[model samples]
Target: MPTDLVLLNSRLLDPGTGGLLPQTALAAADGRIAALGDDRGIGALAGPGTTVVDLKGAVVVPGFTDGHLHPVSGAERTMGVDLSACKDLASVRAALDAARRSLRPGAWLRGWGLDPNAFGEQPVGFAAVGAVLDGVPAAIDLFDAHSMLASPRALELAGIDGPRRFAQASEIVCDADGRPTGLLLEDAACALVEAVAPVPTEGELLDRTAEVLRTMAAAGLTGGHAMDGMRLGFYAELEERGELALRFRIAPWCQPGADADAVAELVRLQGTGGALWQVAGVKLFMDGTIDNGTAWLERPDCHGESTHAFWPDPQRYTEVVGELHRAGVATATHAIGDAAVRHALDAVEKARTEGGREVRHRIEHIETVPDDTVARFARLGVTASMQPTHCCEFTRADHTDNWSRRLGEERASRAFRCRDLWEAGARVVIGSDWPIAPFPPLTVMAGARHRRPSDLSLPPHGPEQALTPLQALQAYTVNPAWTACEERQAGRLAVGFRADLTVLADNPLNVRDTELRDVPVRLTAVAGRVTHRAPDVS
Candidate 1:
């Protein structure tokens, strides 16, 4: 038998049952928890061969699982220039100049998180950014990753020229006279630059995956679900190399017209499974984000214009979702507006009726759900996978008014209603959607509790929607584990559960809503092996 590891003298939070036990000791042996009870008497379970870890004045909770994040995209963004930190065109130019001098000639200059709105009417043209790069081919993605601004050199490299370049679903925004304005929207941006940008070698991707896992682990996240399609091999390679440090649930990207091809590919890659990594499901996008005014709202906005659109054919989306469902795979659809959410629910209902139930399909980002649609989620047995940070970030984006005007005052109350979802008998899971939001679970917890950004002095967006600290913790822990289909084996400190846990500097149960964001992670462990330990703790 393997030697047991014991953690004692700590507050144990069981998100699964919404229970907190004071002064508990948990024992793990052979990568599984062996015992959990009051610390006063549980020490006897630690044999002579056991290694004891005194958690000493800390709170221990299950390892966090980020229900939605693009690990491959996150890693790629990490390797590229981070335009997210740039304040304006001048800063963008400065960063480009630095990247230009550092790279070899003709190398692709890539960047992520460049918001034109952040610059406030500065008219971000590729020429200005291109001049700073000394004419090297370059592409800088907007903060949303839904758009890109590329230089002429980049356009030439990608074989995009004049009006023939952009696809039907995409647009190359040009000046009134039809001159290229350097901005590529939707598929045009992804197709022209990101598609052809040299994919990192398998080894490079694996290394970066390790780095990303470490970074996330340090932030108190033990696992995450990657929602990008292009980087499937990254997860496979990490598991093959035995370098994956954190648990991962991968949801490969899905698109119209490619359902058969994607399903076949997934079948081929099905052998790549790990205790730390698994193909959670397929990811589909029903509509674009609200920040870009592309969420498919039900009714036209008060401004007398529709704020959204769909994927050309609603039936095609339903067909693809059905195919994946028939194959016994789970599905996660991104739906921010009422129309998009309804469309996704309709597809899932059709798929469920045709193929019969298999796994819990989920709708990610229910930003503006309609009043009538709340019961539909529970009726169809679909999971509401949401990101609480979105409420705060969207508030900062100043789009709440748009939602209110489009969805009506009463309908708008359903946004990010974690409590309401639970009340309606719908499973609600939380995620950071990192690279779009911060990864710290504490930040997410605080956002859920306050329903507003910490810096905002205004009253909480919807006080009725706010989750108690205990409820917020479950959203981050047990709820995500259930969504990932790992609740039984993980998400709790039970006798037979996996020994994945995080120790915090302060007990979240006692911490004030505002103080939640300030709480630091003391240590993080996976399967009895310590992965991260804060410098001053342990």
Candidate 2:
């Protein structure tokens, strides 16, 4: 059978073995690999209508998959002022001042990627940037996305005054005087301000989201396990319009108070998808984040916080997990603290032991787990979906960062145990929880190998926790496919597998950790359709 697309003059690399096959070309038809062999042999299989290209000896491997991310939410959050590059209070103020200047009359200023570290000695609050935000009604999200700093005016617009109670582990932070400080912790608290914040029109959001997905494709991500399914309609619209660039496996949220009906709805949502997108699982937060003092730490932090789980009733969470497991629904729970990780693991263990099913369940952000928790992942068959960049960009090696300071020395030392989990025989997958971290797959792979910041100037946070280059590659390629039960159909360059592949300027395994993040992506194809081709690539 004639192939629909052919690529010649390429090096076929196997992510699993760090090997290069003798074949220099491959062909794809009907969105899957049709043939692979020498350039002449595969080239001859191209049909008259086939699109053919010469790679000039570029390296090709199975396309990278972000083991976890929130694509639609990331796009929406980042559409406003970008404070990610701001390093200090002065820089943050300067950026907000600039955005304030450009604001239309009475327009609320919205921004995201505000780093809490920028506050230094001061606490994260509206007052930190209030000088520039007066009368602006601004709501800026901290980098974690679990928290937000709302200006007083924004608070008033949202009708918030003093502290409020939440069913989950969220808080509208109050000062010693019991007055709102503008620092909202966790989703429920942040939603108070977000409810009043301006939102883009549906068309506008759809267009911006499409652009972001293409940008992710350009970064060599052919697919992502989208941790949020709030925008399933948006994905469906894009898929119907042929604008969806990445394959998305969406998991909608199953909140703390989810009833039997909610659990059943999530099960029914299974297999709901379009050509390149689907509703496959459910997302639940076991806890919030350490930076905000909302994570369920086994012990209290320096501020006597983070001692509680997101769910008010902890056993209810276990029950929900078991219910989902019995119904054959896989779950990805957000568990950053040690207690949260242990509980999530326990829930999965219970679900597995009782239900005895082959569901592929996973836990996200195993941030500060102990040695015992690490071993349980493999034993319980739970995949560890970690965002390495969260360690690389957020925390510090000397324990000076807020995340480290809050946990103190011991708990902080166990940060992001990627290598520990992998060595313990657990299936570890890497990702960029985009908007929380950058979504570039190579940067994520590099962070897994180099725990230090991208500049490589700082000392490695947990040098022992660094993954080998090949292991990092497999985390993004092979492991993600296995977690999704698509290993047989994707995650490799074999014939008959999905033609989801990435063409890189250099072999990722051979590139230095510092250079890997910047490695040029020559081409990215999802299901045989080229979504991103460098202008330089012929």
Candidate 3:
């Protein structure tokens, strides 16, 4: 077959063996690898119409895949002010005040990546920043997407005067006198203010989403499992315009109140998508986030919170899982706490036993599971989809961070056990649950190896749980392919695999863990299409 693209003079790294392939060049035809050999042999496969480039000895590997992410929602939420760099209350106030200045009078103020720990010993309510946003209607999403701090004006605009009930474990947190405290836990409560906030037009949002996906490709991500499917149309439109850079497998949310009909609709959504994206599974929430005190923990946090599941009735979640499993639909549930992880595993076990079948069910964010639950992941064939930076950036080694302090010492010590899960025979896939954390694939991989912020000199959190360099690489490539049941066709550099590749300035396996994130992405390609090529690459 005539080759469509060819790379010559490249060092091919086989992630499976964590070594360099003897071949110095490869060719792609019709969106799959066609041949591999020395420079002269592979170069000969490229005909007149083919595009051939000399990699100049760059290192190529299977393109990185974020096993889990939220590109569309992340772009939407973060299109506003970014408070991720704010380290203290004063910095946060300064950022918000600056953002407030940019907005027209009476315009809504929106920000994301607000770290609760910035308050130090103070409570994480809008009151902490109410003075700065006194007149502005603001909705600041905490570092965890599960909660937001709504300014008093924003709450009043949403007509949320006091506490309100929700089907899920959501809360419009109230104070001592039964007045709303401006802390909204979970989606239902946050939506109250978000609905009233300003929104971009459909065109604007689609443009931003396309831009975000391109950024991911530039960051060396060829694909991602989008944990939310709300933006299927956005992806479709991008695909239609030939702007979609990443292959996305979307799993739309099946919330707490979903009935049989809703479950059926989700099943029907499967296989519905454009060329580069598909609704292949359903997303469910076993629990919210720990930072917001909404996670379903075996024991309560220091604040007596995180004691309930996201679903009002736990058995109903199991029933839904069984129904979906019977219909051959995979599910990825957000299980952040120990109790939530246990229940999700139980639900999958029950579903498999009752249906007498197997679907590659996944549990997202197994943040603080115990010893027993770690073994069940492999036993039940559940994939642990975790974001390492969550532990790296959110918590501290000394147990001084809010997440650590809330869980006390014991539960906190088990934070992000990526290594233990992998060693227990479980298939662990790593990702950057973007918008919550940064989405750089190298940054995510560096976190798995270091177990601490790459830029910091702090002691590692649970150093025993750090993954090896090769293990971290596989988590983003081979492991995600195994989780998606595409191992036979992708996640490797062999011929017949999809022509998805990333060319780095240096071999990731050969670089220091701390230096990994700095390795320049020379080129990124998906399905033989060059999605990103650094200017120096030829």
TM-score of each: 0.88, 0.99, 0.99
Q: Candidate 2 on 1-538: residue-level lDDT in tens?
A: 7577799999999988999988999999999998889988887887788889899999999999998888888889998899998889999999999999998998988889988999998988877765787787988889999998898889999999898888888899989998898999988888988888879998999999999998999999899999998878998899888889999899999999999898898999999988888899899999999999989999999999999999999899999999999999989999999999999988988988999797889999988987888888888889999988889888998999999999999999999999989999999999999988888888888888989877777888898999999999999999999999889998899988999999998888899987898989999998889999999888
- Compose the digit string of candidate 3's lDDT tens values, residues 277-313: 8899899999988888999999999999999999999
- Residue 446 deviation, candidate 3, in Å? 0.4
lDDT of 1 by residue, 50-98 (tens): 7677788688998877878877777777678887666567787788788
lDDT, candidate 3, at 228: 91
Superposed model 2: Cα runs more than 4 Å off: none
When sorted by lDDT, best at the front, the candidate numbers are 3, 2, 1
Whose lDDT is greatest here?
Answer: 3
TM-score of 3: 0.99
Candidate closer to the true structure by lDDT (higher is better), 1 or 2: 2
Full-model lDDT for every candidate: 0.75, 0.90, 0.92
Clashing pairs in 2: none
Using lDDT as the measure, name the better of candidate 2 and candidate 3: 3
